[model samples]
Target chain A: MNKNRLTERKILVTGGGAGIGQECVSKCLSEGATVAVLDRKLDKLEKNLEKDVSINSTVLVEVDISVGEQVCRGVKQAAQELGGLDGVVNSAGIDLVSEFDDMNWDDWSKVLDVNLTGAIHVCQQALPYLRLNRSSSIVNIASGAGLVPIQNRVAYCASKAGLIMASKSLAMDLASSDIRVNAVCPGAVDTDLFRQNIRDESDIEQVKSRYAMNRLGEVSEIADVVIFLLSDEASLITGSALAVDGGRVFH
Target chain B: MAGEFFIEFEQFVMKQRKVALVTGCANGIGRASALSLARSGMDLVLVDIEQEGLDVLRKNVIDLGSRSAVICGDCQDEHILDEVFEFAQRDFGAIDVLVNNLGRSAREHASSFLDSSPDTWSAVLDISLMTTLRVTHRAAPSMKRRGWGRIINMSSDTALIGDEGLADYAAAKSGLLGFTRVLARELGSYGITVNAICPGAIKTRAHDHLKPSILEKIKSTIPMNRVGEPEEVAGLVSFLSGDGASYITGQALAINGGRYML
Candidate 1:
């Protein structure tokens, strides 16, 4: 809690406006790293965190990650803002709850475009800056649904699963350059989105029962794991998928 | 390497110092893990087959401002393992973490597949997989009582790749991965997290036996074109033992510099 685990590091976090990505921004900044928050809604994040940290420590890059052109420019801007890049958190993703046969191509492809392709785009664009550093890490926010199938989430599952494999393969390809890549899967977390959606008493209980801990995880819990993976403490780790699920996958 | 992975971070605000027992604490990953845990403010119960390395590691732990107790004996010996547990109970009262670093089976003379007899296979299994089974079995009750525990088992990337001349080591490590998962499921309910660390081409003392040409070949095979350091593997262990890794379990975390991906 009192460690500067990522001291002097520069990090770029996608979807930093809310949820797990927002928490990662706060934690990384508190740990002595300057952060570039790439999001479509920077005003919301700025309002929430303006009081806790100096405005100088954070750089805002407004971009919708799904667009490759925006992502390319955003990655370059973020790298320039933070001086250089040491870490990246590909946390921008959307979950589509639709049956496979009922889903439209736009919806399905959008999910893949944002979650899987956008993440790869960010990594690909940031490669040169990342290579400039002595060591760097890329942590993609994959999900438990990625590794395990869930009903009514064909697109979500596929996108995350693809992101997981992409992360592993990227690690394999970039190991020679000392750029570490890994994916973190969060099972069920207590995000603002989940709080708004799972409102019924039965629905809440049903979700909790799925995990070994019989509860949902906090966004801060997932953020904690993400920062740990980004820091030097995990130097030996590469091409690994870390689960921050609170024992949800045990069954 | 394609393998089982595991890790745990501090889930609760620890008010008391945690105690960890590390087997094969004399050198390499074991020695580095003991030191890293010491640096994390955990008291250590260092175990190994020799007193010299344990003595030195104990001093290093003290230098890091932590307490340690060393026990010298082959952990594969049932009596030695018993003594280790009894000593911990008498002195430390509980072990919050266990590092299974010793991988030698009692009869492991020839590590190569064709040269290894049945005895060699069983010996490797007894030490790597069975010893961990016995120790975890012994440690789980205490962990359950406390509502938290961590177990780290050392596997090799060879277990995933089935590298030439290392079939017995691979089989034993593969078996350890399965045990890691089953226990991670069972003990997870009790707040115990189990995981395995698979290291590839580390420049440990054991590697000293490998010819320079062979070592160079191993390095070439790794995409990073280099061998890993003991401290690097220890860094993973240290992170797994922290509160941040609390949710990671039943995994085989490979630190091979991308030599193989599973």
Candidate 2:
């Protein structure tokens, strides 16, 4: 596919150090957007910049998105560095794998803070710059778990489900401002986070059987969807939770 | 410069030679959708009960430089639908797009739910829902073999809002939403996208028969303060059938100009 689909746009991607977030940053850059990456770690962001070999095209901000103050400052600084913002991809997220009985209050709160509230912080900080553009968009990287229940992931599922609703609410709130908000719900993608959840070959096979595609998704598959939602191609699309989960979730 | 770009794009699409089967293609949104797909360089298999309208649309499609096979018959007839698919296979080799635009509420029976007869319910369900199910069933296997297809079912805002006095119509159209969602899930692995378009108050021949005062009142109810053009809904159908909408499936998109939001 052509990479120049996002020409002349400026975008910020949170959780850009790894997994789906990292893929979004790379794809956005390739699609001809000057990008700002916010992540708790700077190593992957630096590597992405080095691979692109154009230092001026990207801004890397080291900050925890879960912290509201850090998110506000980092988003402002990145917007300043990129000159402005046309879109934001809230791909920053954390997952906790625990049954309801094993989960504590801190575990549940941590998941919600990073996945749901973190997205809210980024949207709040980026709204000013996003509104300046006539057709800006926000793509929240939610999960298939958000739409359907998965066993042993009570907190993770709750956080993502809340994020999906938050995405729709934001879409309605921002429609008058001309900023479209949508979510991409990916299922069992072969990312760092997904690999961490698999304990053996049997687990991989089991997960594969769950999808109609009979395999895990590539990070690029999910990233391509995020890029499409952020682009002008999806102009009429808002308040939509597009499932790029190989038919795992329907909505 | 724009003209030159359009010419170049048209040539590119013509080279692809996509094939589309559009039912109820004689007038209104169906005809507009057929023409829009032709503009996108798709050869069409047009079906409608009106022969004269089909001839006109066939001429127009030929003028657009796209081949068209016109069949004048009721789409709800299983034999007619079978013949449509057979003709598509014989001429176009495989159907790349299926636009299920054959549907209508029974105007004569537009009374309260309790006042409606079983015949009205059957007719509405047969015309609006069963036709979609039958056609999609026939076209799906060919689409699965080709590994790519776009199926767009025409539903209505009544399905979403459950408007009074149109209980039968609402039930039929609402059934389409559930059908589209399940079919999308079943066919996604085969690269076939199933989506429904829910339009409200589009200016069509059916509405021309309505009293002017009633039409005006309907327009007043719309937030856009005007009735929608058939071509407006056609634009969305064209988009849903195109490459840009590959990831979108099982969605019932509203094109009612803010009259309804989902």
- Could you give candidate 1's per-residue lDDT for residues A103-218 as a string of tens digits? 99999999999999999999999999999988899999999888877778899999999999999999989988899998998988887666766668898899877766566788
Task: Report the TM-score of chain B alone for all candidates.
Answer: 0.90, 0.93
| Model 2: how far residue A46 lies from native, Å | 4.1
Number of backbone-clashing residue pairs for each candidate, in the order shown: 14, 1
Alpha carbon lDDT of each predicted model: 0.84, 0.84
Local lDDT at B156 for model 2: 92
Where in model 1 is the C-alpha error above 4 Å?
A196-199, A248-251, B1-15, B105-108
Q: Could you give me the TM-score of model 1 versus the true structure?
A: 0.93
lDDT of 2 by residue, A137-170 (tens): 9999999899987889999999899998898788
How far is B120's C-alpha from truth in model 1 (Å)? 1.0
Compute each candidate's TM-score over C-alphas.
0.93, 0.82
- Position B76, candidate 2: lDDT: 84
Error of 2 at B61 (Å): 5.8
Candidate 2 Cα errors over 4 Å, as ranges? A3-5, A30-32, A45-55, B1-17, B25-42, B49-68, B107-109, B185-193, B197-262
